[model samples]
Target: MHLERLVFILEVVGQKGRATVADICAQSDLPKPTAYRLVQDLVSSGLLESPARGSFAIGKRLRRITLSDYSDPALLEVIAPVLANAASAYGAAFFLSRLRGHWVEILHVATPETGVSYLHPGIGKRPLHACSCAKAIAAVSPELLSRDELKGQLRQYTEHTITNREDLAAELEAIRAKGYAECVEELERGISSVATTLTKTGAGSTVSIGATASVRVFTPATRNKIGKALSEMSQELSCALGWNDADAERICA
Candidate 1:
C-alpha cells in the first residue's frame, strides 16, 4: 500500500503541471486498476486535486505544506511594516524571508522610494549557503548545516562568495555571536546586503530580514548602521514571537 501510494505521488508531481490517471499509470509502470484506486485514494485524502475532468495535479494540501507557517497573519503584519520602514529609511530594497527546506524563500519585499536602481523583487528561492538572509538563519539554525544533508561542495555565486565549508562555518558562528550577517558584492557583483535572523521560542522556524544597496552606496559605516537597525528589528520581532529575555539579549547584544 505504501509503495503504491508513493508511486502515485511521484507520478502526480512528475507531471509537473497536471496529468490524467492514465498518464500517471503509464509513468508509474502500474496496472490501470491499481493506479485508479491509488489516485482515487489520494484525491479523497486531499493529497491530489482534479481541476479538470480527468487531469490531476498537486492539491491545496500539498501547496500548503510549502507555506504552512507563512499563513500566520500576526507574523505577516508585524514584519511587513518593519521591512517597509527599512526600505524607506535607507532608500534601498528590503526583504523578508524564511528558511524553507534546503532553500530560503523570500516572502516579502519593499522597493526603494527614489526608484533609482532596479528593484530585484525578493519573492523567490535563494541558496542557503550563499544568500545573506539564508546565511543569517543558518547561523542560528544548526539543522540547516547538518553534516548529513549538505556535507561538502558549497557553490560560489561570485568571486567574493565563501566556498570553503570551514571558513563558512566560522563566518556563521560570528554571525550568530554578532546577531547579523553581511555580504559585500558576494552574491552579485554590485550588490551589498546585510541580514539578521529571528528565531522565536527556540523551536519555531527562523526568519530573516535583508536590506540591499548598490555597492557604491554601501560604505562600511552605512553597512554598520543598517546592520544595527536590522539587529534591533529582528529582536523586536523575536520578542513578539515569544523569545526569552536571554535569547533576545543574545540576538540584540
Candidate 2:
C-alpha cells in the first residue's frame, strides 16, 4: 500500500509537470496529510524537487536515472550508423555525450580505423569546461553553469584551457552564434575538437555529439569541415530523436 501510494504521487507530479500538496491530494485521491507526507518523502530522498514552499517537480535523481538508461541497446543501434558515417567523412573520432549534474558523461565513441593520435578521455565523466562535447552541450544550455560554478571548476588541464570565467563566457557566446564549440588542446596537448549539441532528451537534458583529432589533423580547413559535419550530424540525430525538423534546423543553424 505504501509503495502504491508513492508511485501514485510520483505519477501525478510527472503528469502535471509540478504539483502542490493540494494538487497531489486531489489528483491521487489521497487524504491531504497522506499526500503531503508522501511528497515530502520523495523530496527528501531526492526523487522529486521542491521548487517552492509547497510545489514539487521531478528532480535530478530522476533525471540521472533516465540519463543512465540512455545506454539502451535500441538507441545505440540507431546511432551507430550515423557515428560511423561522421567518423568516416571527417577522418576523426566521433562521440556522443550528455550533460549530467556538473559533469559531462560520455555515452559512446566511434573511432576511425587509423584511430586518433590524441589520448581519448575514455568513456566516463569529464570536466564540463575542458572538453568540446561538454562545451557544445553547455553552449546550448548556458544556465547549467552559474558564474560561480564556472569559476570554481576552471581548473586548467593544459596551457590552452580557458581558465578565466569571463573568457569562457565569451567563447561560449561565440560557439552559440556559430552553432558549434571547439577545444584546442584544452584538455590535452596536441588534441583539438569540434562539437555540437545533438538533441535534448524527452526529460529536457542536453545530449551532444563531436569529432576530435590531433591538432596536426585538425587544420583550419579540417576544423571548418568538422564543424559543419558536426552541425549536420546533430540535425540528423535530432530528427531521428523526433525533434521537429524546422526547430532542429534553427538550433543547429
Candidate 3:
C-alpha cells in the first residue's frame, strides 16, 4: 500500500537518524527510484531534511510536531507498551494521567479483563489531593498547588482525604523523598494505589503513571512491590523522555 510504503520510509529514516536514497531503499526494500521520489517528497514537505546532496534527516517540522504532542500530553506511542506491561505484571489497573491547571486528567488506562475489577478512573478532571497519580504529580511540583491556591481548597472525598494544607504538604514531602505516592481509602473507600511521576517539565507540571486496586487485595508486601515497580518504570519512562537520573532527581527535588 502507498501509506504502508510511506510509513516504512519514514521508519527507516527515523531509525537511522540520517539516510541516503541507497540506505532508504535497502531498509525499505523499495526500488531506488521509488525511494528517491518518496524521500524527495518528504524533504519538500518539510518532514525530512536534506543536509547534503544525498543524505536526509528528520526535519524541523517533524521535531516541532513531536514536541507539540509531548506538550499536549498525548504521547501514547511511548506510554502504551509500558502501561500494558505494568498492568499485566502487577495485576492491577494501570493509568497514565496529565496535570492540567488544578486537575489531573486520566489520559489512558490499562487493566486485565477477567482478573481485575474495572479500575477505570474515568476520563475527566480529578482532584489532586486524594489519588496516587495526582499525588505523584504534586510531589514533583508542589508549586502547582501553591500557584492555583488549591492547598487550602482541597475537598474531602472520604474520611482519609488530606483536608488541611499542613498535612497535605507533609504527605507531599514524604512522597518526594520516597519517589512515589501511595493512597489507601483516601479518594474512595477500600481502594488503594501507588504512583510515580513519569515525565518532568520546565513548566512545573508533571505526568504520572499509577496502578490501583482494592484495599482488601493490597497487602503491605503488594504495596511495596507495586511501589518499587512504579518507581522503576517511572525512571525508565523519564530516561526515554531525555531525563537522566540526575535530571530527574533535581526536577523532583
- Which candidate has the highest lDDT of all? 3
lDDT of 3 by residue, 61-136 (tens): 9888866335333356777788887777767789887765456767788886557554655665567888888988
The C-alpha lDDT values of all candidates are 0.71, 0.73, 0.75
The predicted structure with the larger TM-score, 1 or 3, is 1
Task: lDDT for model 3, please.
Answer: 0.75
lDDT of 1 by residue, 1-253 (tens): 6775655454344323566767655444568887777878878978778898887777788667744233334456778887787787778889988654456768788876766663464577777778788888888876667745476647788998888877888999888777788888777898888888765335233678888887788788888898899878877877666643565756545
Candidate 3 segments exceeding 4 Å error: 1-68, 71-74, 113-118, 199-205, 245-253
TM-score winner, 1 or 2: 1
Tens-place lDDT per residue, model 2, 174-236, is 988888888889999988888888653342236777887888888878888888977777777
Ranking by lDDT: 3, 2, 1
- Of the candidates numbered 1 and 2, which has the greater lDDT value? 2
Write down the TM-score of every candidate.
0.68, 0.67, 0.67
